[model samples]
Target chain A: MRLTRRDALAVLAGLGITGGALGLSTLDPTAADGDGSSGDRDPAETDLLATMTAAAEVVYPSQVTGVGEFVETYVTGRSRDASRQAAMETVVSELDEIARDWHGAPFADLAADDRDDLLRELGVADSEPVPEGNVSERVRFYVVNELLYAFYASPTGGRLVGIENPIGHAGGTDSYQRAAMDGGQSDVNAGENDG
Target chain B: MADERARAPVADADVCIVGAGPAGGIVAHRLAESGQNVVVLEAGPRFDGDRREQLEAHVRPGLDGPWEMGGPRDAFSSSGESFYPLNAARVKGVGGTTLHWQGMVMRLHERDFELDSRHGVGADWPLDYDDLKPYYAEAERELGVAGAMDNPYAPPRDDPFPMTAFPPSHSDSIFAEACERLGLDMHSVPSARNAEPYDGRSPCVGYGTCKPVCPSGAKYTAESHVEKAEAAGARVIDRARVRRLEHDESGERVVAAAYTTPDGETHRQAADQFVVACGGVETVRLLLLSESDRHPNGLANSSGVLGRYFMDHLFAGMGGRLDRPTRQNHVGFNTSECHQFYDDTEPVNGVKLEFLNYAGPSPVIDALHADTWGDELLEQLDESYGTHISMGALVEQLPRADNYVGLDRETTDDLGDPVPEVHWSIDDQTKTALSRANEVQASVLDELGVDVEWTVGPDNTGPAFHHMGTARMGDDPDSSVVDAECRTHDVRNLWIAGSSVFPTGGAMNPTLTIAALAVRLASSLRARLS
Candidate 1:
């Protein structure tokens, strides 16, 4: 009844097995998709990671390269529920189909501007929240918030704003204003906040 | 006896104090020093000095760990529609709940005593401010409270604080500027934390982790007084849970107390004097548990006011983000107070503006899920991190007889004791006060040039662990539970201390007032012992 972003995707990906209802032919998985490459992780699960990374690159471009890979690895490593992991695979595969239809390429291979344009169309830029919606809004949720969390979870992402280590990482800003107090400067106007 | 959990076989004492907490510490110290043998029972063991550091956290005490929180399922919200956090905020070790107090010490307003005269609601205290003023001074000295000697906003006092106030942080500057712009009076909240080395304790390092647990012991915990009480010839028996009070045949006098060991051994201690210093909820629970045919409703229930008129300040929360990046000054506990709204208000309502130290993760979490990401996320963090500030108005709530804590027959603790069920819902008066508090906070936020984020008031008002009333102190036996001396009306030798005895909770933090009352009760106990 209630499906997570991942679950909806897995079910939609399976729908491509029947062929051409929503023109989701490319979203169908190959025989090798669930080959269980790394320590029993299904190949479909691996592809889901790749799709998540591609979505993250849309949010934070791989400016010097490897940022996308970082996003993929970080997002994949966070374990949700194996019970719904199959659905998550479907979601990721359907994303590839959408990207192929939009730009005639895999979601990960699309140009940065094209990705942003697609994200905008998904209404990620709008005031609406992602998780609050349904299967109809799955792709946008995956590309925007889900991918963004994966990207931000990485150390490279943390470095972008000068938080050397965020919570769930290691070490942190012990005193945000102690130095200012020690220096006898009462008024402070400049400082970055790490949420 | 830090973490030692001493099990003394002895059962005789000149005085028996249930709950080795703030009230217990002060009473034990005072009475034991006067050469009366004292036995203090503690339900929870103290954290070893070495472990205390590890136990300290930046989070609120309730969220820290399971070990720090003692006692039954903290379910005071069992009935209240309001969001009062009864169980999470309170601690039950040797230091009691003061183990995690933020140390924002302030005296009750002078007119706080005559609530009946001022607002025609809530009963007036049997004694006036003058009666307790001297004891307040003594408590301040004992705690080595730090504040401005000539603070304009405070009530008149004979002497200045023992220590000067800490230097203002960036947060203080923001608050001061806003107060000045709005023509409001602001003052440094009196801190129990030492500004300089006093009583062999270190000063506050501004670690910003005062709540939950203070590692350095810079912020005073009742553990300090527990230690003092021990050194001055009192014994604190840790993990000795006092479940019942045994009285004489007529149920007019408390003869002894029965407590259970952690391993299920029951022990009884006989004493001439008994004081229930186990905070508001537990003290009332103990009295109710001691019910017998002679006192069928509950011990000291002849007045039928054993647990009623519960009160806590209605805190209205208003938050905002400044247009420009500013260093948020919440490194220490909330230090600034806008008391301009405190005095001259009707007894039914008064407001005190206090800022809460908040380094919110909301912006970062929002960015993580928003239209922006990567470099833009970083930019947003830089612009918004320290810019977040909260202005909370602690509005006074008048005590009502129905908002109470009583025994729930259906529920039981681990020891098969009835759990205290709280029935609290904010009244119409509280709703009006919350609206006023919200408006004042919004106006103050407007002064600081920030868009108001949200308002917290009666609509979503939280139930509290800051428990008061239940066994309130007043002049009459028919209308109240205790007298001016904090002695239960039905029991002559039995007394109760802490905020539970407060007839009216003034628009300020209650620790100082609790300690002041304990000192006053200590004086009374000394006279009785003599």
Candidate 2:
């Protein structure tokens, strides 16, 4: 049931969570997933998402509502696409290989700071042997960016940017200036404002 | 009086406006306000706040959504490239294509009207920039255009813009400095949006989702004018696909138009005057479909040029990491443009430099292009998302006789109407413009101390949705479809509006131009009918 923002609105509306709030979705990122319940993730699938979710957590670090659950579901949706799944598998395997070579353990098992350090090291490494095209960039854009947006993608992130109900989000809250109704004010407003 | 005698009229009015886009809406509003009966037929459904939210929801999840800005899919487009050759994210219905437009409201350069005299390539417009200046002002007033008065590149006007330009984003400052260092002129992009609430619309909150949908109606759409038209006593019928125009004997003037409803019922609407603003493609399709015993080659094809000279802008650009963190794409996006090359009439021609708008393809999407996805891909999105700045050249496309739209008699629309077969190609001028664009890209990036990581287009450069010239307006009846007033040469009372009458595709979005011309046409029709 990977609910869209529209569906999430319906569910939230049912609960009377009706104020135009962005953090409402931030409170429960996993609410977008099928059934709005976190108990249904397959153990194997959860394990696969563990590394990506942890990496996303490092980017924003739960500043508001926990983004980990929402990210897992978002990645789950990506993994469902065959092309995305292939790309993720290639990049995730490469990341796990790098972690094992660096610390004798899988990437998902690394300490939170250690995971952050791994990303930072890879961010600036001069001679790291991981190929830099598909696996290299996908690691950032696909896995990390999507994971990072899991928090930023929610209504909560839009509020931080001063837009309580950013367009493209589920909320339809409007914030307009009253004078826009006077369609005939052609020159007065034009002369008053400076670019 | 003519409408009262009609037997089974679904609707009837003094003027019947086909296509409830910016052009149709403005004409309806003007005629209705002048005490003339007007009926507007829109092929798309009406758009409102709830619909905006739903469309906005489609844009929420990155670029991997069903449609950009939640616009409906074009069932008849040719998807042979990364983007459709003719139209991508082009909309139909009540708000019309403006529902998904990015709200760029720039006027054509004054020189654009005389491209034939200036460049010796395209046909000259019947009216000059000064002739359309008043209508442009009226259109800006109607659509709420925010602009800067100091920009030398903008078209000169008597009054100031309706609103001041949007405040500079962090990216705008960087882009300005880089452009200055590179010796290129740049300024705030004149936009059809409120900088601070006006006309009951909220100022732009910089949500960066203008394409495909304006989530908060902060941006103007045809729906705004549609509402005004309705308020002025104009009746708008949505989801009414116009089939063909019926003309009187001698093929001199149009009498009525037949349109089909969503439920497959046909109805005839007669009016004293008729307007066809069915975008660039459908307008030609309708004319071709209206061919009768007297006019065998299409209703307005006496010169055999009704479907000829189709054109759209060519987009080419380069992007790389900025010297410092701009954090630009987060808000007030696409607010800068450089028109230094826009007035060039010689070798370089008009090449508009628009500041970076949307983020490029994701690493995975990019990797798919490269045929591999590796480990370092994750970090690149961060490096590029906020860290990179880009500029693109929107090169002017000179109208050519070969690029045309015609009826593909083999295919039919959902309503059994003939589909439009778009025949467009990148001409030599576009090729020259591409070469110049590449040089422009190189020089700008070098001055900014950024290396060109990826360059898109020089050959087969992407299609810009500013479709124009299928039924171009010119002084010469020998080589044009319509007169200077956008009225068809073969038909007396039938007029063409929108970009379809553009003699040349200027390096600017055609929405404002279309609205302005529609306003001018409305005045012309009012005078004629009064």
TM-score of chain A of each: 0.55, 0.60
Cα displacement (angstroms), candidate 2, residue B285, comes to 0.2
User: Second chain of candidate 2: TM-score?
Assistant: 0.90
TM-score of each: 0.72, 0.74
Error of 1 at B513 (Å): 0.6
* TM-score of the second chain for every model: 0.92, 0.90
All candidates: CA RMSD (Å): 12.0, 10.2
Residue B397 CA displacement from its true place in model 2, Å = 1.0
Worst 10 residues of 2 chain B by lDDT: B364-373
lDDT by residue for model 1 (A110-164), tens: 8767766766664556634333354325554544655554333223343344332
lDDT of 2 by residue, B112-221 (tens): 89877866778789999999999999999999998888678777889989898876555666666767877777777888877778777767644445666555567888
